[model samples]
Target: MITVDFSLFPVGPGDRVLDLGCGGGRHAFEVYRRGADIVAFDQNENDLAEVADMFAAMRAAGEAPAESEAAAETVTGDALDTPFGDDSFDRVIASEIFEHIPHDTAAMAELHRVLRPGGIAAVTVPSWLPERLCWALSEDYHTNEGGHVRIYTRAELEAKLKAAGFLIGPHHHAHALHAPYWWIKCAVGTSNEDHPLASAYHRMLVWDMMKAPKTTRTTERLLNPLIGKSVVVYLRKPHRGSAESTG
Candidate 1:
């Protein structure tokens, strides 16, 4: 499910976009469909391979625009040190990834380094309240290999972005419907991925995403203010001369 809203990100056609730590290329796919030149960057070789193949498949299937030929590439590298040159992209999306890196600042700095002046970054993390509840219910949520390493309060995350030289912009909650399912999973067992109840909830989420029923949409709207699963912050790197303008 997408936790970041591209409308808030403001990417137009022909923009160069990077999806940092793009696990399975979910967001990257959306950017490509929007006609942005996309790069799905991740450290997982298997995931990169799949993303590359999917890009080819998408091209053949005409899933994108006729000019969708701008195409996406899979770049495998560390988040703290990407292979591209400085100021290499018009937009960057590092969703649901900051918490995984122990040195999240370095990763944020890398994001800043690669963005052109006025470029936007959309960073999503587990929202504080729901995430705290998950951790309270299950230690495994935090301890699992490559699982979420920490929970972020919006303030802390925004502050870190500011320190990395981004002008913190609009921010909000997302994935409100996914929070309860996670709570159920954590209450049961993090590894119990196939348990009947958890499995049912998982399928329901897939349906909610794939079909987007009105009922789930209404439910998500209601719960967003209360127990949203993800916190998304939009930020931008300032032009050299305009750093003081934010003041």
Candidate 2:
């Protein structure tokens, strides 16, 4: 499911976009559909291959706009050392990625380096309280390889991004209803898919995503600011020669 809200992170037609640490290419696909030149960058070769296949399929099926000049390509690389030149992309998406990287400052630096002046970066991570609950409920949740290495308070994250030279903007929370689902999973067992409560919750989430009934949508909107599972922060690279650019 997509976490970054496109309304808050605007991408004009033909805008260059990068989906850093793109897991399964959900956001990349959306960027492509919007007629932006998008690069789905990830470390996993298998996932990149799948994203490439999906891009080809979307082109073949005419899912992209007829007059749109958008194109999508996959890049396999490290987040801390991307293969792009300085000031390359107009927009960058780094959702559900920071928590997984131990050297988050380095990764954030790279994100800042590749974004053009006045470009936007949309970053998301597990919200503090909900993530704390998950960690408390199950040690396995954060201890596994490639699992979340740390949790971030809103202040901590904002400070780090500011230190990286991004001007922080409006922020919001998302996926409120999904918090309890994970709590249930951690309470039972990370791999216990057969748990009745967990299975039922999963089914409900699937239905909500696919059908998007009015009730769930309204409920999620109301609950999001309070207990949402993910926190989305929008940041902008300062325009070149601006006062903030001195950093």
Candidate 3:
């Protein structure tokens, strides 16, 4: 499921895109389908292999536009150190990834380094309030292997992006509907797949995603303004000649 809205990122056909830390390749798939030259960059070789296989499968099935063949590639690399030349992609997407990195400033710098002048990057992180609640509700939620290391306030995240050489853009919250499901998971046990309450909530979420029920949809719309689970922020690298500030 997409946490960040693509409209805010505003990519087009022929755009060179990078989905940083592209676990399981959800956002990367979207980029390829839109006729973008996409690289799913991650350190996990196995994950890259899976994403590469899916890319081939999609090409064979014509699941993407006929123009989409080989437009997608997978790169195994550290987030703090992407392998592309400087100013490579027109757009970069780093969703649900910042929290996992300890040196996120360095990672942000790397994202800034790889974007062409004026190219945009979209970032999604766990919203502070909902994430705080999750942490308060369950230790397992943030303490597990590869679990989130920290929750970021929007201001702090925005500041880091700006410091890393990005111009701030419109920001908003998303995935309100999924917040409660996580809260429920924490209330029971983060890994409690068989717990009755968690199971019921999971099914409801599945139905919501597949069926898009009006009741849940409307509720989420209302809740998103209040306590959405994910915070999406758009950023842009300044075009050449833009003034840089130390302030």
Error of 1 at 151 (Å): 1.4
- Which of the predicted structures, 2 or 3, would earn the higher TM-score when compared with the native? 2
**In candidate 2, what are the lDDT values of residues 55-131, reduced to their tens digit?**
98898899975534777889999999999999999999999999999999999999999999999999999999999
Per-residue lDDT of candidate 3, residues 1-247 (tens digit): 8776888776667789999999999999988877778889998899999999998888889876564243788889999988899999999999989999999999999999999998988999999999999999999999999899999999999999998888898888888878888999999888889999889988988988899888988988789867999989898899889975322
Computed on alpha carbons, the lDDT of every model, listed in order, comes to: 0.88, 0.94, 0.88
TM-score of each model, paired residue for residue? 0.95, 0.96, 0.94
Sort all candidates by lDDT, best to worst.
Answer: 2, 1, 3
Worst 10 residues of 1 by lDDT: 63-72
On TM-score, the candidate that comes out on top is 2
Model 2 scores what on Cα lDDT?
0.94
lDDT of 1 by residue, 1-247 (tens): 6778878887657799999999999899888888889989999999999998888888879887554347678888999899989999999999889999999999999999999998888999989999999999999889989988878899999899999999988877888888889999999998898889999999988888889999989989888878998888888899988854332
Q: What lDDT would candidate 3 get against the real structure?
A: 0.88
Q: List runs of model 1 lying over 4 Å from the truth.
A: 66-68, 244-247
Per-prediction CA RMSD (Å): 1.6, 2.0, 2.3
